[model samples]
Target: MSRSRRRPGRCRNPNWFGQMAVQLDLGLHRLGFGMEELDHLISDPQWCAEMVPDLMLAHLPSGNDRLSQRNVADRDRFLKMTAQLSGFRKSVAASSGIFLGAEFHFDVVRPGSALFGINPMRGSANPMLPVVTLESRIIQRRHLKAGTRFGYDRSFTAEQDMLVGIVSFGAMDGVLFSPRPGQKISVFLDTHTAPVIGSGGSDTLFVDLSDVPDRACREGQIVSLINHQHDLETCAFEHGITEYELLARLGSRLPRKTCPIVLPPCIGKQGAINTRDQTSR
Candidate 1:
C-alpha cells in the first residue's frame, strides 16, 4: 500500500494473528508473518516436534486478482509447501481468499469483512451483511442565491436558488476535505439522497437538501450519512482515500446510540470509582 509522507496516519486493515473461536484455522501474511513467528517459537527440536500446525493460514499479495494465473500459481506453491508439513487437518483461505472458491477452502475459511457487509470479492458485488448505519441531525438549513459563496475560502458556490443543510460532521469529526472539484459524495435522508456541498467548519459540512421536501429537509431531522446508495466503498473511491482509511477515520467522535442488546452490569475493580462517580473528582 502506497502512503503519503505528510499524513502518515491512514486507515488500513487490521493485522490479526490468529483466533480459535472463529475456527479460522491458522494463517499468516507477508508470507503469513506468523509462519516466521512460529519458526522462531518452534526452532528448538523439542518444541518443534511438539508443535503441530492445524492449517497453513496464508495471505495473498494485495492488488492481485483472486482468480488470476499468478494467484493460482502462488496457491499451488502454498499447498505444495504445506504438503511437506504433516498432520495439518486442512488449508484455509483468508477473507478475500474465500472468493476463490472450494480450492481455497480445504477444511476451513475465515470471513471477516464479509460479516460486516464489505464485499469479500474485489471488484464484484457485495454479498455480506451491513452491520453499520450512521446518522446525524441537521443543525441548520440555509437558502442561498447562485452567486453566494460558502465554506473554507468560499470553495463552493450556489449554482442556482438552492437550500443546504449544515450537517453536524466536519474536520473535527474526521471528515476529509473534498478530493477534487467535482466528486460527488452524499448522505441519505429516508428515501431521498442529498449530495455533500462542502465543509464549512471544524464541526460541520453542508449537504444539498434543495430537492427534499421542506418538512423532511428542515433542521433537526436526522439523516443517514451512509447507506447502500453511497456505500462505504463508493464513498471511499469518490474521495481518493483508502477504504481502510475511510472506514477507520469516520464516527470516532460520534455518540453511540443505545444498543439493542443489554450488556450485563459490571462492578468496579477494587476501589475503582464508577464513571458516574469519577466526574465529581
Candidate 2:
C-alpha cells in the first residue's frame, strides 16, 4: 500500500503517485495474490526479478532537548536499516530533518514549515517563500488622557495624552497581543507606511498608533501583517507552541480578504496582473 506519514489522514484528492499505487494493487489482485502476498512480492528476489521498491520516506526527529530527544545515532540506525533491507531509489527527510545536513538529505527533503520561510532551528538562515499576510482595518481613533487605563486588564495606562488607533483586528484575528521590547511592526496606509509600537502582554496586543503622521488614517484604514521581516516561529516559541498550532488557532470569523499576490484564482476573482506583456497589450 502507498502511504505517507507526513500527511496522516484520509485522502480527498489523491496525487499521480497515489493513483499509480491503486492501479498496481488491482493488477496484483487480478493475478491471484493476496494483500500479504503482494507485500512479499517487492522483497522476494525470486517473486519478481525486474521489480524493485522505488521510494522510501524517512522521518527524522529533531534533536531539540526541550521538544524532542531524537539524536544523530537514531537517524543513522534507521538509514542503515533501510539500506540493508531494500534498494531505495530515493529517500526523503521529513520536516525538521532538513536542518540535519547532507547525511539526512539522502535524495529529497519533505519540509512543510521551511517551505513557508519559518526557521524552526534558531540561528539558521531561512530561504523559503513566506505564505501568510494579515491585515486589519482601523475602527476608530481617539486621544486618551494622561493616566487613562485601557483594555480589559488595564494593560497600558497612558503616561501622556496619546493618539490611539483602535483596529478591528485583535488577538482573535491572529494578530499576536504580546511583543518583545523594540520589536518592529508596520501598518499600510494609502500606499504609505506607518510604524506601530507593540507593547503589552502576549494575549492582548497593544500598538502605539500615535506616531502615524497621516491624518487620513482616521478610520477604515487597512494595516498589513508584514511577514517579510517578522519571525513567526520566534513568536510561536514565545507563545509555547508549534508554528502549525499558531496558524491553526487563527479564528475564521475575521473577514479575510486574500492578497491576490499569491492566492489562487478560485480564492477570489483574479486581480489585474501587472506585467510587460499586459502593459504592452
Candidate 3:
C-alpha cells in the first residue's frame, strides 16, 4: 500500500488499466499493507471501485517458523479477511508452504527458489532436480618434488612427488582460495575427485590430480566444480556460506550456457534435431 497515492490516479485512467494485486503483511514486514490498513482500504468505496484488484497475495518470508503458533494464527487471520473478496484470486504459498498442507495453497502458488533447484525448506533434503553445472577447463599441470612448497604463501608442502592440475576456476569465480579449517574442497572428473591444493590465484586453482587417471588429468580436460554430487548447497556448506551467497558470488566473466531440454519421443526426430542444432549453434 506504499503506492496508494499513485494507485487511485492510475486505476481511474481507462487507458492505464491493468491486472492489479494487493499484498497483505501477514508477518513478513518486508512489503504489504498491515492488517489494520486492510480494513481501511476495503472500506473506501471510491478506492475499491477505482482500484479493482484481480489478485490477493500474502507472502510468508520465513519458512523456518512457518508452522509455529504465531504464523498459523496470522495465516488464519489473513484467510478470514481475504475470504470476503469473491472475485479476487489468491496466492499465499511458496516452496516451503507446499509441505504445510493444502489450506495454505490458494488459487496460485509462487515457488521462487524451488524453480532454480534450490531447496525451499532449509534443513530438509532437496527434492528438485539440479539444473546448474559449474565446470572449468584444465589449463596446465605441474610435477612437484617432495618438500616443494605450492601456491600463495606456500600453504602446502608436498609429502612426495605428485601431479597437480591448474584449473581455470578461482576465488574470483565464487570458489574459495583455501579450504576452511576441518574442510576439504575438491573438483571432480568422471568418478574421481581431486582435492584443491593450497591457496587460489585470481583466475586459477591447483588441484591434486595424482589420484585421478592420467588421461583425465590432461590439459583442457573438464573438471566439475559444482555438479550433482557437489551441488550448490553442498559446495556452499563446505565454503562456510549459504547457497544464495555462493550463487550470487559467481564471477560475471564466466560463460553460461543452458542445457538442452529433452523432449519425449512423441515430439519426433525433427524436434530433437532442431533442439540439438540450436544448442550446437
Ranking the candidates on lDDT from highest down gives: 3, 1, 2
lDDT of 2: 0.52
Q: TM-score, each model?
A: 0.68, 0.56, 0.82
- Candidate 1 on 148-246: residue-level lDDT in tens? 998888988898989988888777776653445766777888888788876546788788999998878778898886665667776777877766577
- In candidate 1, how many clashes are counted? 6
Better by lDDT, candidate 3 or 2? 3
The best candidate in terms of lDDT: 3
Tens digit of per-residue lDDT, candidate 3, span 193-270: 999878888889889998899987899999998888888888888888877777888888899887874545677889
User: 58-124 in candidate 2: lDDT tens per residue?
Assistant: 4444432213445465555545445443554434354456555556566555666655556546455
> Sort by TM-score, best first: what order?
3, 1, 2
What are the lDDT scores of the predictions, listed in order?
A: 0.61, 0.52, 0.77
